[model samples]
Target: MPATPASDDLREGSGARALLRLATPVVASRLGIMAMGLVDTVVVGRYSSAELGYHALAWAVTGVVLTTGLGLLSGVQVMTSQAIGEGREADTGAILRRGLVYAGWIALAAALFLAVTGGPMLHAFGLSAGLADGATPVLQVQAVSLIPIIVADAGLFWLEAHGRAVPGMLAMWAANVVNLIVNLWLVPGGNFLGVDGAVASGWATFASRLFLLVLLAWIILSWRRARELGVLTPAPRAPHAAQAMRRVGYGAAASYFIESLAFSAMAIFAGWISITAVAVWAVVINVAAVVFMVPLGLSVATSVLVGRAYGARDQVGMLQSAGQGFAFTTAVLLAVSVGVWLFPEGIAAAYSRDAVVIAGIASAMILSSLFFVADGLQVVAAQSLRARSDIVAPTATHLFSYVVVMMPLAWWLGVRQGGGVDGLIWAIVIASTLSAVLLWGRFAWLARRPLVPLAQPRAA
Candidate 1:
């Protein structure tokens, strides 16, 4: 039998501790993800900055394809979590079935896009024909494995729906270890092959993800008792669940798309300053992303919990989860911000040696640390709001914050005022703060007068 929290545990008073307990897995998962990114950049940086740039850009492009489909993972998580929260075993099964179907389609699309259309597109971006050519085979081979990665995403979401996040966390962390080992063993100096080493890294990602998928499958079989719980059926239909998922998926994707575009454009902004500026900007963004892993995980936990409450139509639970989650995210980021602000230079130096690069990155990191806190809060609040099925707010917020607010503000401050890169960094801070304030306000309003998604699958 699946373990359930004590009766009193679900009450509003216990929400914070319960949310924290829920958040632990997410924190570990996010850290695992950060470690993987850090290691990838560090190991590749050992080869050359040029190689780092090439690899980063390549990975980014590949991500654009796979990451979008992984969008369904959140959709499944939100909907399935809601199902679990409502105590509808049949609905959970139905939601999982739909999620698996969507995952499969996303995997196929990733495979084809990377194999066929991906390379020439990169070449068009001014990559040396040779470097682009060299990366193609790697991308294609890696694309074949991208499907498995999304499968892992689906598995993790399934686990999250059941409030069993540790297995998912372990699966991803294990993937990180496998990646590190493979990179050490196969990459250029380690494997004695230059371009071939990078290729090996992609294959390693594939191998690790596939392994995790199997382990996750095992967990589902054993712990879930999915069959006995009545959450597994021969066939399930959940278009309503799918629709609810897509509602958030589309919103989150919009937010993701705009944020990614803004940062990607920062590279262009750096190019205006100098080549070294690009390198510096790269380091700052990378480190920032790693730092973000902390709040990102927290935000996701909030979403799952809030999404569950939203599903249950439990207004008090929704408000408590949202409040405690936001408070937790803010507290965590405040600590992080203080540390980064105090020693931006120290942090940058740890990543790179060039004095100019270090100075720029430190300046950027210091200026941007608080910005991340705001961004973190906004992301969680916005996601929870979406889980409540108030999708228009997050959409408007993304458009208003990034496209309307940040992009224009960045140009004025960064370019018009000639604040240059630091000016651009300040723009991010401005947008993030607004996003947090606005999202929190909106969340407060929604929690007061909640909007629920589709009715709980009609009680079996």
Candidate 2:
């Protein structure tokens, strides 16, 4: 196979253009992810605030597992880009295959873990018996959907690494259409299965995810370059390839797990306040997450660019890519923050009909906007670090910022001090700012060090 050219032209000015071109579709694709959650939140919140609380608690547990699995699969994107940078495009297919298998095992393990322990875990949080009980079955139903979505992500990441974000983006929005249809049909007592409310929403999630997996598979398998890219063939045996992939993933998985676990803990703190508090925090976090998709997309794009540069031993290209990514992320998030701050009440009103819940969400939403730029910068910086294989620093930084700093502060301010939902948002603001500073500093330090190429894969 001919060696595919890495982006040799990725220098000072061209890097920004490349970043924008890749980030546009990638951001839209990430939005499709949060858009599904937004739909579920809106549909269930309007149906019943109590049900929304059930949904939020259930998701708090599921979200942690989901993110950790996605983190473990992050190597698919990193390794694929690295291989292409090394001019070995054929190797990406093996990476995808390995990623799919790994994704399957992680999903199954997580689903079973949730099925067996989800109820007890919720109960252990000291939530009211009714809240715990209502969330248990919903969590289990959500567990069933995990298998499809995690596996689907492997394919999506592979496509994104090849600069083919459009297919995945289109497939995701198509899945959203499926999710919306099911949500509308089932969430408002329209289903004959006797399930309604949050549980029905859970089933909708399962259906849509299954549809997404099937659709994405068809797209990948049908691509004209599929065979040429080695998609149809077994990956040549390279003893170190799988190990390299997992090595990259381990740090990312740890970082994602720690951060997600801490954020989910915020929901637990809100639960301790009131069911109404949980419902409000749900709306605030969902909106923030929706906005966050932009930066997460930027992070993925930047990581690909940096990983390629790193693989090619091009320090200048790596720095340029990282710089462009940071500037773009900051500018985009600042604009989004202003928009979110300007219309918090209007945004909150769309999620729920209850005056009390809307009021709570609106205030918290305003507070949450303060963290948007910091949060965006932090993720972009972290991903850039990982692209260059400086993985442990980002993981350690997240652990300190989120678990050590944000978690206790959230409890202290939100629960101990009676500041409620607004307090939780404040905690996030502080932690995110600190994380951004630390991660960017680490990236700056690493970029100054001598460059080294990763070990090449052994021949089959």
Candidate 3:
């Protein structure tokens, strides 16, 4: 049958419908990733609250490194999407090849840094001896998982850029299933290894990460068109390829560090207040992170669409993608805001059974919902800007918002003014709002002008 124009628009698949198609499984993939932490928190929180605190602190440290490393490889997705738009699809294989090498180095360096410094870094934060003692082993075990996880991310990003998000989604959930099984077996204190509950959870995470890496790599290698996609051969030198990837990576990495480090510092500050404060803080942040997966998925999908448009110099398409991303993010956050505000207790209870922790988490979550909305906006805006090759402004905004604004406010409001966890959440709300406004404004201005490609052809 001949297709009508309306049917063609729907079937051709570009715009919000297309964006949603891409976002659904990507959101699932993001949620699957978040579920690992959620599972760990639930399992360990039930096993022992004290162990939960240790798990939280260890994760706080690890989260900074994990996010920053992911940021360092952000170029793989951006570049691959752009390559497709530019009719340079074959270059994507080289992008993947280079990205893998970069991922390996990043993973190795991160693992080594964490292994050597994680224990002392906890001590340096002036944590209670008990907290530090409990968290160090967990931290060390988590350090080992970084290698597998980061390398796996390189594959995930590569496949996702080619619009193959379902495979990554499946791999992520499969890893989560493995994570849950291992946590059940190991965190109950009856294991042959005799590991503590917190450390046992860490081992589960390490094993799952290893599984994820293997599964993703196998999927990439076994892809039916692997050679046609350039994965099976050496790439001809494109003078700008390596340089462009590194440039994008550095800016993104710095932006990631600014935000993650600021939050990690807040966790450390929570430690200074009381063991209970950090514990409650952990529960609050974990729940917020679970909700955040939706926007994170949107941001990734939006960036790909925008990058494709930018590569093809389709200004209209770029704006449409960005606008749609912001609209969807705002709508989702509004709904999430209502849920968090009305049922903070229910949300907090899912993580911890203790009355005091639940009360603290609920109170903090009420304030944190505002932060979540602003954070959702800012991340989507930042990714959209990066897709247009406007990277530095987002980095600068992150520095100002997270480092200059958030850090000081967190210290003063949270500690000196005695607002505790609630104060820290408020600080995040302010910083995220500032970042969102600034980044969106920048994207608006940049979109009005032309966007240059990340790489240009060398002299003929």
Candidate 4:
């Protein structure tokens, strides 16, 4: 079937219902992404707190690269959605092909960069020799997995853009099963492979990512509309289309890189405090990340709606989509914050039995809750802005809120003031609030201006 135009129902004040419908599976899929990491952190933590520290630090480094790569490929979703909204469904296959090629090069460069420089970079962080050495191997193993995950994300994003989120969600959960089984078999000492600790968990991540890539590839290839959508044929040359996709990705990549780098710096600060502090910081951040996926998913859904509306030249539809998205994000995050605040200890205990780590995590987790709503809202606002092609504003907002504001504050409060993990959480809370305010304001300002469809690349 050809792409349908944005329906009147969406413009008739049913946007909230539409947003929820699209967001549910997307949220579950996003949770699946975080669930894999949650399992890793829990398994590694249970195996040994010291090993958990290694795993945390390694992941902190890897996470920055992985998320940035994902951001670069975000155009796969945006372009695909815009094509559909413009009733150029066949053009989406070209978008996917370009995204896949982009994913491949990005994966290779990232993997090589990490393999070559990850270890020395760890050493330069002033971590103890033992900590740096212990994390090096794990980081290298994770580097290998980046290839599969990054490529898989491109396929996943394309499918999600086409409103086929369930397949990706199922594929991700299946991979999680693979990850869990391998982690259980290898993370404990005396395993058949003789591998344990963070290294073993790293292998599990690699296996799961490989599985995820293969599964998603199969799904895309076997999609019922593959031929009709031009997936089976070569995409014709279209420089403008490719350029448009990359242009959007450039801003998103910058935003994602800056934000992730700032957050990763918090882990470095935690390491400076104590090795145990790394474990505590990991647990707190992991929980916060899991919560973050909900908003991230909602953001994707919101962006899709906004992109579609922008394509159809429906300004009212765009505003309604964003309004519904913001309301839903706030409500969901508030509920989550309450749960985290009320039972921080119970949540912390799930990760590790280390008494000191648990205490530290519990306190920091409570403070972390304060930022959940703001953090969630900021991402939603940023994505919505991108969907409307107001990309630079979000990038600039994040640069200021996260890098310029949050990073130095984290260093001072968490390090100089000796507030440790809690201090870092405080910095995040302030930065997220500032980011949300700025992005929301940008969107509102743009809403007041004349509405124009983002220029559609001409077919050659």
Candidate 5:
């Protein structure tokens, strides 16, 4: 009925301690999201390396839309957190309602665009006919699943902005269980569903995502404060609220698109090299993504804290939260880097048993380990900038590092130099380090200036 003293103390604690408390469950939730794909990759890779190749190719295409869609709706989280700090907590429900409408349209548009053009895009890549043909169905299925997952993300973002990360963590892991069980049943090729291998993995994804959306909806409906929090009913429209959401969404979406394009293009480049290269890239990227969830979770925590501080005009708190996030991310990733370096083969073997694939993935993982800290740093920095409503610089950094630098380098090293998968990993390493340096430099420059108060929500 009443808030505990300890809870208030935690809310008012030093940035480092408060962030640690927030980030722990946030990281778990991010990892739970990644684990669903991890299970799909492992199951399909085990069933057939060829099928795994199909799965990777399909995901490469779907990932661009999925990630960009999430980015487009990130305004939901950013605005909600700022609302709390601005003493406009009542605005959060309106943010969620708007986010759902925005997310639904984006998801539908992406699904349609992908369904119509995905196969042709794969064919246009000049990949082997077999690879392109096989991936088309998988891509279509993955595309369909995006509708539910992206809409569900609005609810997840709303909950996390309110310091309710634990529920999302629980719901995501529960969905993971569903994904794993279904994958186990359908991926080995003899199911009544008439789906097998990578295709079965796609169906499992659709099922799990649907479950996730339903679970989140239930949570929101049953939340005791749902009405009081303005989550169940719409708040009176603030004049600039819609514009504010779009402002954040567009910048975030651009940054996300540029970066996702870089990685997805690399996957295509790997396919251009060889089927084996595609498989190895899948393994390496999968490992990197699993590790990436750590920083991503930290990014979410840092953004929320930074937004609140910005809203309250607490520049010192904003800086402290961001700094602690960077420090914590580097420390965790450094340990991860060491572990991955020491046991690349052990790690790669979990996805595929093929000796050649394992060797190739091991070598790439070694190089990837070297860049983990840089990768983690850049994300936290970028997210912190967004929370402060300084979104343009991060988009520029991505454009410079990923589009202007990473893409060409990947092609030149991996293709022109004939270095195969190792070459692509090296390209990512160089770009990620550059992005980290540039983004942190930008943050430092921004920190020295006077803090900009959070913008008022515009009239709807």
Candidate 6:
């Protein structure tokens, strides 16, 4: 028999070093992406609140529709991590090649649809003349970048899949460096590009990030160890490879739509209160984006750990991975909650300085921190579910929490009850609490299996 795989070593390690080995840079990767979004808001805010809201409108719309594309990796990341655990490293390429095929269609349809419909859709949320005109072009051009983001996402998921999270983190940093440099040159005040200068900056960001991410993908793809990510060149093809890809892709798309629709609605509804309210809401949401990195990183790590355990068929290992993830997520988030509490005004100031803007945003940030703590729980649990290939249960939990319950609650707090931003905060809290309860319940049910050694495939 072939020697045991490294994945078996990880499944066995279950030590501090092993967990850190997975989490440290994965957390750094999360931070790098957060920094990039912060740079976008800070740069755009240099113009005017109206301009910032314009970019905000564009980005919020995309978040609702485009972010779901990230779900495409629910399989690649979790399943690949599991496969690697079984020492089946040589069969990954066919899936990647097929992913590119699927992502292409998704990026194109999503981009075209957004380009054609941004104005009317935005108007429904009460966009103004300056905001509407400015928002439409920014989103349309940015939509073009979505194709690259989707294509590049394959590389990102692959890195996480292989437990090499550092490369993905570096790629995001490299993209950020390029974006900051180019956007500065592109968006100087009163430039020939006008508000379109901002558009040019967004375009530059997409191009540079794509180039850097693809380059990193090439370097990593060439590793001797990474051979598993490739379908064995001479290995006989699996008969159902194409079908598996379709199944994973379609499932991811559905998950994306439901989640995005619910999250996006929060922004759309906030826009109705007042334009300034929209601006304040935008600042709060973006700041939440910065605060969210910790949990996001933890969740990705949890997913990898869960998938690896599942692959090894190690019942105890699965529970340990999830338990540690939950512990780490809560511990870190609790610390973050303090920072969010002690420095709400200071944090809001980093993104905006207008008195009305700061005051309105500060109230939301304090309350929103509570929601994210709960939100952090759900993120880790849900990703853990994805890691074990138990995708459907978590999907149902999120649907019920965000759509069935959170939406109406948000409307009540922010609108029906005249609570303003605090209302939105409570709405998120409601959804997040429900999500945590359901995910914990589901994870408990899945962790009761017996161990089985991974079966090595026969040589072709």
Model 5 C-alpha lDDT per residue in residues 394-430, reported as the tens digit of each score? 9999999999999999999999999998889888999
Write down the lDDT of every candidate, Cα atoms only: 0.72, 0.90, 0.88, 0.90, 0.89, 0.72
Each candidate: how many clashes? 0, 0, 0, 0, 9, 5
Q: What are the runs in model 4 whose C-alpha is more than 4 Å off?
A: 1-13, 453-457
lDDT of 2 at 44: 95
Against the hidden true structure, what lDDT does model 5 obtain?
0.89
Q: For candidate 3, what's the RMSD?
A: 3.3
Residues 137-161 of candidate 4: C-alpha lDDT, one tens digit per residue: 9999999999999999999998888
Which lDDT tens digits does candidate 3 get at residues 311-393? 77889999999999999999998999988899988888887888998889888888887877789999999999888788899
lDDT of 6 by residue, 1-460 (tens): 2534434434445444566677778888778876766787777776567778777888888876666776764555655676655556565565555555667777888788888887778777665666677788888877777777777777677666666677777787888888787677666645565544457657766766677657666756666665654533443455465555455545555656776687677777777677777778888788777777788888888778777767767677778888988998889889888888888898778767688888887887888788778888888887887777666787788788888898888888887888877888788888888889888888887666555564564221
Runs in model 5 lying further than 4 Å from the true structure: 1-10, 452-460
lDDT of 1: 0.72
Query: In model 6, what are the clashing residue pairs, if there are any?
Result: 89-228, 90-228, 92-229, 93-230, 93-231
Native-vs-model 2 lDDT? 0.90
* Candidate no. 5 TM-score: 0.97
Q: Considering TM-score, which of the candidate structures 5 and 6 is the better prediction for this target?
A: 5
TM-score of every candidate? 0.88, 0.97, 0.95, 0.97, 0.97, 0.91
- Count of backbone collisions in candidate 5: 9
User: What would the per-residue lDDT of candidate 2 be over residues 1-460, giving only the tens digit for each residue?
Assistant: 3433323323224778888877899999999999999999999998999999999999999999999999999988998988877777776788888888889999999999999999999999999999999999999999999999999999999998888888899999999999999999999995787899999999999999999999999999998778877788887766678888888899899999999999999999999999889999899889988998999999999999998888788999999999999999999999999998999999989999999998998888888889999999999999999998888999999999999999999999999999999889999999999999999999998877989655664321
